[model samples]
Target: MRLAIFLLIFCIFEYALTVDQTNFKTCDQSSFCRRCRKVKPDNPKFALVPGTLNIYSDSITADLIHKDNKHLFSLKLEALEQSNTFRLLVDEKTPLKPRYKVQDALKSAPKPGSIKVHEGDTEFTITSGPNKAVVTADPFRVDFYQNDILTVSVNAKGLMTFEHLRPKPQQPADGENAENPAANDVKEADEIDDPGAWEENFKSHHDSKPYGPEAIALDFSFPEAEVLFGIPEHADSFALKSTSGTDPYRLYNVDVFEYIIDSKMALYGSVPVIYGHGGGTIVPKKERIRRAATLMKNDPYTLVVCLNSAGKAEGTIYLDDEKSYNYRKGEYNYINMKFENNVLDVNFIGKPNFKTAAWIERVVIAGLGRIPKSATLIIDGASQELEILPHGEGVAVRKPGISVQQIYNIRLNF
Candidate 1:
């Protein structure tokens, strides 16, 4: 009994040590996360076929069903605005439910741009501006080209899998009216409580996954880039390392107990972002808009940030009329932005999930409904160079110490 009490005291001691919320999760706290860290290389599934395509005003999305239907997998391709960055998303279409998108890092919803897609002998030509873009797609491989130079390739190694969400049926093949009433009830109960899919209770924490198995995994290779960076919220160094024999970068956002230093684990905020570094890489900071001394940084050279909304990004991107976000227009200012004019505001990026995010916002507000609005929101705008004074509850979530979030402090300059 002494040992159990000692362990409990240790956990509490560790939890009290962290502030500023930088370190989110240690590698050990997460279950599937720890499992993914120890993956092997022998087989990666690369299934691609000419599935279907949908065209909208600004963005165009295409579905890629795996050649091996054994795994119900689908990949989405999107042409976004500004630099016409092509975004590819891979996930299980009919997962138990849906996946959550954490693409709030993008300052605005990128506009849909045009791509000159032409059929080639083996591959295809997809160019937007002056660059000669190429896409070589087959059943098990995908290669991207820029100016005849192969840049990024997906599924090159082939170990991409989307753990499909399935209902726990006592027997999948059980008839609608099974002979045994007891057996049917048990099957129904199991589906309601599929431990493998949703409702994961870990370490005195109950994570109610309204949407079931929506895990996304794929291998992207940057043949030219030797160094990579940009997946903040971890205590690790700026530069990333090989998770080959280790863990794939964790993306789930959770309130970790006592996150470790220099390890791959989910944190308070997640930006599913990465960039090539070293040769021609900038200091990662951009010029400040109002000259508060903190300039936004420069974006990474190459990246693959995934955005899977509540159920899907389906029909969501099209809902926006003029909802294309470039660099400097939104709720969250882009730290490292590529903009012509200097404009900083708090906003969101990617396509339309405003409604979906609204639902999330409502849930958040409802759960913390007891907290007054005056106390809940920190009213601070960087453009005006002003801050809000927290009533009596004290600084909520942030401290206004030489940072932009000081806007929450209502201290007007007289």
Candidate 2:
């Protein structure tokens, strides 16, 4: 009993010291984040320059100016081929030095799509397929719409804070401003100054930053979203919570010691991709595969098959253009495959059900340089046949019947 009490007390003590929050910096400690958080909503400080838009087939570039300091920035918005994905980029028009751009970030370059521009006096809209982005001129903001529904807005809260590269200020000599104290005070009031912008000290480490602040910050709002997710590699809830009364979530990666489970502290890596979902429908099983085939008919689908002696099944299929970079537009054709005993229930409406219920046992997609009209289906080494049906730039193959708990192989010849 004495030994059991000692072990129980030790476990409680260790749980209490799981994480030390003081080792990390909060929003108040980060100068750039602190200044950005102070920006009030509805008070934007940037505007689009008139007559500076250069519209291309797949992208649109424009000049944006800061309303306060009149800083010139170049903006580019590109549309991906999947029709619903867009990439927006902003940078200094002419910088003192080249800024760092992430490289090798994607598996392949995204396939660009042709965009149609609709210009207006105060706002302009760029559209690809059913997706549209309306860009406002004054107090520059981009409202992204999927299927005509407003889903995401950039710089809507006007919390954008970009600190351009600047030379360090020379310290004034003692008594230099004593003669003109009133004038110096007026000049200081008008200057945008933050003591931590040049250097920061955490614990005993004093970082001597030679270059002035180059931190960039922007706010995104999801007006009609039911929940926000992404910004992965965080040990927090899958659905993000409001940072209203707490420090805003930080994205810098660090090797934290015994990181807190429910906190937003960065772990090993960071991928700054945040997306919001509004509303969706739950399709029934009878119509699920049919709907998936219809939705992904235009794109090439990936077929993954996993087999094991154990009675379980799992796989995935991501639909995309085989030779184009269009998959970056987000989750339009992402499908998760999971089943028990490798039983794939394929329901073909208006067709008779038979005892030989043919299902996808294994699929191998190779040398698909072109779309084929039919595919060869093989089941249990006893049956080998070709199911042929010409789809709209796609192929639909159906096998009449095959018993369950048997291995199946499908080969596509393109």
Best by TM-score: 2
Candidate achieving the largest lDDT: 2
> How many clashes in each candidate?
28, 3
Cα displacement (angstroms), candidate 2, residue 267, comes to: 3.0
Query: What TM-score does prediction 1 earn?
Result: 0.51
Candidate 1 stretches with Cα past 4 Å from truth are 1-31, 34-42, 50-63, 67-74, 91-98, 102-107, 171-200, 206-212, 244-249, 252-269, 278-414
* lDDT on C-alpha atoms for all candidate structures: 0.44, 0.64
TM-score of each: 0.51, 0.65
Q: For model 1, what is the C-alpha lDDT against the true structure?
A: 0.44
| Cα lDDT for residue 141, candidate 1 | 52
Compared with the true structure, what per-residue lDDT tens digits does model 1 show for residues 390-413?
A: 323221222222232121222212
Off by over 4 Å in 2: 12-17, 174-190, 280-414
For candidate 1, the 10 contiguous residues with the lowest summed lDDT are 358-367
